[model samples]
Target: MQSALLVNGTLISDESVRQEDILIRNNRIISTGNNLSGQPGETNIIDAGRKYIIPGGIDPHVHFALPTPEGCSCDDFHSGSLAAMAGGTTFIMDFVTPAPGQNLIEALSLRRQEAESCLLPYRLHVGLTWYDHTITSQMQQCVNEEGITSFKVYLAYKGSIGIEYHELEKVMHAAASLNAIVLVHCEEGDLILKKQREFVAAGKTSPLYHALSRPPETEASAVKKVIDLCRKTGCRTYIVHTSAAKSLQYIRAAKAEGLPLYCETCPQYLLLDESVYRKPLPASLKYVISPPIRGREDREALWVALRDGTVDVVATDHCPFNTFGQKDKGADNFTLIPNGAGGVEHRLALLYTYGVLTKKISLQQFVALTSVNAARIFGLFPDKGSLRPGSTADVVLLDPDYTSVISADNGLQQCDSDIYEGMPISGKFSVVTAESV
Candidate 1:
């Protein structure tokens, strides 16, 4: 086992920052406090020297090597994990969407095998698109035997991956029975399909129309539906990649009533807006993500949500596709373009610059949004998201003074276009250490 000591660093916890030294052995932090000592030959000493030592970020939502009809996302486990680590994210919770007629356990087994080469430790949230006795039983097996505590459901993508209303209620009941958390993609599928038809018929099929087709109401309506179901069934529910400010009202009301409901928004939702859809032809397609970026008002609302605790975490929702082959497939029709963006390699630095440096949120709030909250919600708390003693030694050294501009050439994801290109950013990761895989 390799043992090491990190000296003279300010540790960012959920509450505050404190100067401390951390001692690591066998890939775990054995102790953390002032004046920690280590034997010379037994432990290597790393002088952190005024850097911020924060727990490695855990992105609760990420899709790596996702298979779509167009093609697999450009970033697989290997490249995605590398990008995540480069950005100081130590663990990610990805999904396992089983194929038609495929057993849930088998799908998880195969996905785990496929992800054997991933550099960082990872966990899976099984997607339950359809429900039956067998599938319901499998859900229990996943929680009990596979150690997966979170399940995902889609309210959009109708006919394909979306869950029917009645079936979703039953699934929620089942999840509640097992004390499992349900994560949902909240958007009314039928409403989006109808709007798409209207847009295409009017010869308005540009990339900008992608945003027009799914208006804020589409997401807000679905968010309300999930909240109602969670309230009825008593299941802990989390909404993913929430992009609309209208949806925040529902989340806020639910939280006020003490419902076990939580929601996460991504970096693009906070910083980017719908204008990206109107950029150039091929360049604009990169921002055609689902639940597309909203107006400037919504962007400001997300920042407020982060500050006031309406938004529990900030994740990447990182599903990267190349511009050449993947995005060009939908040149004539925006609907064909795969929806996602690459941000795993830039999440930490971007948030630090915009969220912390700009005074929108405090450093402690940043730590909670980036790491601690997700850990507690997703059952990886002390082990993965805290710098406390006996926690897995997943640590990041953040240099607050570093400054740079964003570009694809310096990123680790297997992608051609950088959505945040030319964006000025301060603060970079000096070093990152992940627990043994």
Candidate 2:
């Protein structure tokens, strides 16, 4: 049996942090306590002095190898997982997007095959791209047989992948029936399309116009609509990449009403602002993600939500494309740019520096946002998000004193440019251990 012992580290969980030693056998944590011992010759003893040992992060939102009209996203499963591992994430959840009229199960199987190259343990949230009588049964089959408990739906792609309110309601009902959670990309489709047309017609076809087209109201309206549907259908709903301050009031109210609503915001929405879009041609293009990075008020509001428990998780909607080849395609028209940027490799470090060091959030809250809460919401808790005995041995040893500047060249992601380029980060991952089950 493979064995190892991590000694003299501060172990942190969502609940507490304490100095402890963790013993591991094979892929499981054997025990954790003070002075845990193992055979000297047979076991690997790691000296984790002055390091903070936390559960490996679980990013519930990422889009590796996502196919768009321009091309597939730059990082496929293997490359994306490598970036994730380097950033201290051990388990990641990606989506299984089905083609029109394709079988959901078949799509999931193919996605699984593609994900086989991933270096980290992973899960998939099946996308509900269309509605049909067969979809309910398909969702049930996915949950019962495939172990997929979460479904995703888009509200902004309009005619292509975006579903109408009626369709969303039907999906919410189906998810409620199966006790599965629905992750919604909250943007008003019609408003976005109308604004895009207006911007293009007015000759304002720049990256900044991308943010103008999908304003805060567009997101906030969708959030309110989804919360209403959740209340009506009693479906557990999660809003992904929430980027607006106005949207938070709806989320906060829904959560206060005891509706099964969870809100997730990405690091970009928290750290970056709409000002990045004002930078220059391609430099600004990299930040043109859907629900485009908002203004300073929105960023500060998201940080408040993160600290106040209004935000449930922080994930990177980490779909990346080359700035030259892909994003530049939309230079003449902002609508054509692939709507994403790379952050899977930077989520933990960014959160540690900005959230923890800045006192915006505590270390325990950091653990919760980065790993624990996502696992619990997505049903991977205790095993994937915990350092308890018998839990999967996915742990990260983070050195608090180490600091570094982030750039695409040094990052493991396959993307050519980074949105977080030149951002200084404190705390580095000294050791990452992921034991396979």
Task: Score every model by TM-score.
Answer: 0.97, 0.97
lDDT, residue 300, model 2? 93
The candidate that wins on TM-score is: 2
Query: How well is each residue in 176-225 modelled by candidate 2, as lDDT tens digits?
Result: 99999999999999999999999999999999999999999999999999
Clashing pairs in 1: none
Which lDDT tens digits does candidate 1 get at residues 71-189?
Answer: 99989999999999888899988999887768999999988887888888889899986666687789889988988888999888887888777888888888898899999999999
Show the lowest summed lDDT stretch of 10 residues, model 1: 428-437
lDDT of each: 0.88, 0.91
Error of 2 at 330 (Å): 1.0
What's the distance in Å from true for residue 38, model 1?
0.6
